[model samples]
Target chain A: MKGLIVKDLLLIKENWKQLLIFVLIFIVIGLEGNQILTFVPVFLSLMVLLSTFSYDDYNKWNSYAVTLPNGRKNIVRAKYIASICLSAFAILFTYLLITISGMMNHHLNLEETAVTLLGCWSAVVLLQSFMYPLIFKVGLEKGRIFLFVFFIGVSALLGLVFQNIKISLPVEVISFLNHYLVIILPFVMIILLYISYKISEKIVQKKEF
Target chain B: MNAIEIKGLVKKYDDKFQLGKLDLTIPKGVIVGLIGENGAGKTTLLKAILNIIHIDSGTIKINGEDNKKEEKKENIGVVLDNMFFPEILTAKDIELAMRGMFKKWDTQVYYNYLKEFELPLDKPIKALSKGMRKKLEIITALSHHPDILILDEATSGLDPVVRNEILDIFLNFIQDENHTIILSTHITSDLEHVADKIVFIDQGKIVLDQDRDELIDHYGILKCDPSQMEQVKKEDYLCYKKNKYDVEFLVADRDKTRKKYPNSVVDKVTLEELMLLMIKGVK
Candidate 1:
């Protein structure tokens, strides 16, 4: 597993300049808007994870990986580990940016910021959980198409919710769901991520080189 | 103990192609050359042994244990026709990755091979030529000190000089009495130079499995007319092909056949002739 991780890290390192440019662009966009800063890291981390797959696919590395001592199961696990690490880095970057911006702009609200950060983390986890199984099943190219369609569908649903649903939830109900979500979402996402990992393992195990 | 054992191994690609009930045993301390034409299940058999592709129904044992075990994989090294390293990674990066992967990885030996092969440590794999990439693959495969080395067309695209250099490395690899190699190739001449045993496959069936010298020494092609062909016993010949003028018989026992047919012209069989006769001749 360590070997597989080293390989992935080296692959990512090759594109460091491209990633740095992405970070710089996001940082600039982030200064103008706090939401962009909060969400871009999650997006960037996912892109980084996807780029590793692209490299793997290009050289058919997965076929070679099966011949290695770690085998296919560990290969799948290594991708998940890489994704988790990248997501963690993105979250840390988001936190630092938000903290710095908060210090510079007194108008930022701490309570609202905490809720938004939690939401960002949940989104990243959910995206990974959704994308991983698809990638394992159909591979990165087809999985990317599915992920794109899913994102578009989600955005459309959100647009509908904001545009058509004028009725507001009761304050008691809103507070109840929000309080429970803060506690429950992370646990649920973790469980879902575990299940996703297992599914990916099964998919990869059945795959022919 | 044999380095590899397969019992009733069957893999089906589709209706037209299938490896049916194949059984083979490759003993330790020798190079077993797997000779076959394109689509003859050479790669399929290699992949099945490595567990790269799932077998439909079969048992594969490596070094007396089930080949599927992770521990068994540690003793095996593989090089496929297509190099699998990430193009963006340098040879040094591969060393780092392999050090973590193989428990028996020898860093010093790896560097030595890199120097010997003249592979640049800093160049990305994509930047290297085809022959250079193959050399890198061979270096990694050898550095781990595996008990069994499985190569599928590892020398196909290499020039004669490079191929000879690689073959010399293979010869050196087998100097240890415990090390074994299963090299799959259509290049019969390469096998003739170093292989101890030869296993020929055609359309997923084992056509011939014999010692290298046994085949080279005893196997013969008897060229005779149709009337002379009739005089040769059917059981004595492995297979025979008839041209317009003469019949070519592939006999397993050359001296016996020569004694049996004193007037017939008997010629020594090369590995290429053996493979071609098995593939093209009727059973």
Candidate 2:
């Protein structure tokens, strides 16, 4: 496990600059720029993760991992642990930057800042819990293609509906979302994460190379 | 106890290939060449032995323990055509990785192999040429001083000069009379001089497995006039080939036949000739 973590840390060391850029971009999103693009950094982090995954795929390193002294379970666990750690890092980085910016602007409050950061991390985890399992099942390339097309199609359809009609979200619905997101989103995402582990084990077992 | 043993090891990939119930015993202290045609389960057998490929049904033992046991890997070192290292890592990084990964890793020996192989220790693995990358892998695998080594097509891409140099290292390792190697290669001569035993696998079954000297002495290549081919005992030859003008058959023993047919052109057989004759069959 320590060896696996060292490997991951070396990878992170190679990409520290990019990770810093992600934090900078998100701080900009939270502080001064359009709030809409705050999702971009977390989303962009996936590209870094995807590129790493691509490196592994192209090199056929996954097969080698199993051949090592490490067990297949550790190989899979290392990947998930790497992903989870990165997710937490992004959450911490984004939260700290936002809080610092707020203090500089003299509008800093602890509760609201914590809430926003929690929201960002939760949303990213929820999306990852869905997307990563798909990636594991189908592979990084095909899964990314399917997910990209589906995300775009859904976004466009939502845009079209919004443009064609004006149905303002009710106050009750907004309050329900705010109150329920913390309780509902994580529970669902955790279950999905567990399912992904099971699916990943099955995929690793059956993979030929 | 055998260093390695396999019983009823069956692996099938649809109609492409099948390794059916392979029974093998590799005792300690000898190099074994696994010779086979392309897609003949040379790599598949290595993979199955390493548990890199899923097996249908069978048992594999290493040092009298199940090969599947995590602790068993401590005694096994493997080199394949595939790159096992991450692209971004340098040889120095690998030294660190291996130190943590393998309890027996010897840094001095690792660098010695790098110096011997002329592979740069500071260059990123991806930046190195194919041969250099392979050298790094060889260094890493050997650093742990595994009792048994398994190499799959490990020497194919290397130039003859480099291959010869590496073969010298293999010979040195076997001098201990306790280390073993299962080398898989199409270049029959690569393992020809070094391998103690040769196992010819064709379409996933053991076509031939015998001690090198014994097989060489027993297996004689007899070239004769085409018309004289029918006179040779059919059962005595493992297989034979015929051209319009000449005939060549690999007989199991030269001395036995020499006593019977002094005039027959009986010559020593090579692993390359044997492999080709076996694969091409009588044509």
Per-model CA lDDT versus the true structure: 0.88, 0.78
Alpha-carbon DockQ of candidate 2? 0.53
* Model 2 spans with C-alpha error above 4 angstroms: A12-41, A149-180
- Highest TM-score: give the candidate number: 1
lDDT of 2 by residue, B36-56 (tens): 899888888998888888899
Model 1, A31-123: lDDT tens per residue? Answer: 554565677787778888788888888788888888888588789999899888988888778777776676676656666766777788788
DockQ, all models? 0.74, 0.53
Angstrom error of the Cα, residue A198, model 1: value is: 1.0
Off by over 4 Å in 1: A28-35, A107-111, A147-173, B225-228
Interface RMSD of each: 1.1, 1.8
lDDT by residue (tens digit), candidate 1, B1-283: 8888899999998799998688999988999999999999999999999998889998999999987886568888889878488898999999999988889999999999999888999999989998899989988998888989999999897899999989999999999999999999999999999999999998899988999999999999999998777787888898998879998899988999999889999999999988888888866
Could you tell me how far off, in angstroms, the CA of residue B173 lies in candidate 1 after the best superposition? 0.7
Residue B254, model 2: lDDT of 83
